[model samples]
Target: MKRILVIAIPLLLLTGCMHLNDPRPKHYKAPVTTVANKVCVIVQPEADEQIVTIRINEIGNDNNTLEKYGLAVIASAERCVTDFGYAFTAGKAYNFMVILESPEKKKRGVQPSARIYGASFSLWRLNGKLQATPLY
Candidate 1:
């Protein structure tokens, strides 16, 4: 029993250290190197519109190229917030989309508070972080 215990413990410990040198996402077809890092998008708030609940998500585009770069979605959150931001890998440039939704009470005559806004940004990371300018 003692001999078996000693051998099994070291074998398990060695398994954890085997992949310490290689750092790459597990699902990629090839190794990815270029990435934008931390990217942020500034969401504009409308004074006329009252916001009670706000949810922002990095939606899949026509190509659905979020993970194709490096941006991964955290559950339904998508790593995007009311601030609206995300970063992706380089190599092949692809479109990224965010759906920011603010639901309000339904008005009898007016349309629901739901609205979809779209914009393209040309921004890069500086010192591992980038803040997006307001889309106005």
Candidate 2:
């Protein structure tokens, strides 16, 4: 439809113009802090040269809507493990998401690629270690 194309074309063009040097997060919604306790989260890219974003959500019980708990941007490949400093309540469910982006190709002066990849996982803490079971 015309309405769909009007919005989609400009979005595609804008993303296609994104450069590889723009590795920082444009905005963040959650106020998250970190601690060096007996907790850790590991996220690795399936391919090299990608931007990574992490989102933590709480699975609903009485309130069935998942609430966003934390958001983080991991730019470039340095370290993959981070402690979100959130205390995981026993017997509760949480969702962990890793979003990867490569708005442009690895080389300069080439047409922008504008690709996004992601993986979602169910989180659990067993025996003082964190476990992430992939959902997708």
Give one digit per residue, the lDDT tens place, for model 2 in 1-136. 9999999999999998887666553321221112332323343443433444444455674343222333334444345434354445544555544444443443553333223333334555666655655544
All candidates: CA RMSD (Å):
18.0, 10.6
Pairs with steric clashes in candidate 1: none
For candidate 1, the per-residue lDDT at 113 reads 37
Error of 1 at 6 (Å): 99
What is the lDDT of every predicted structure here?
A: 0.35, 0.44
Query: Which whole-number lDDT from 0 to 100 does residue 109 have in model 2?
Result: 39
In the range 1-136, model 1's lDDT, one tens digit per residue, is 9999999999999998987744331221111122345443323433233223322323334443332222222213222322333334322233333332233323433343333333343344446654343222
* Model 1, global lDDT: 0.35
The residue ranges of model 1 lying beyond 4 angstroms of the native Cα positions read 1-36, 45-87, 91-94, 107-109, 122-136
**Candidate 2, residue 64: CA error in Å?**
10
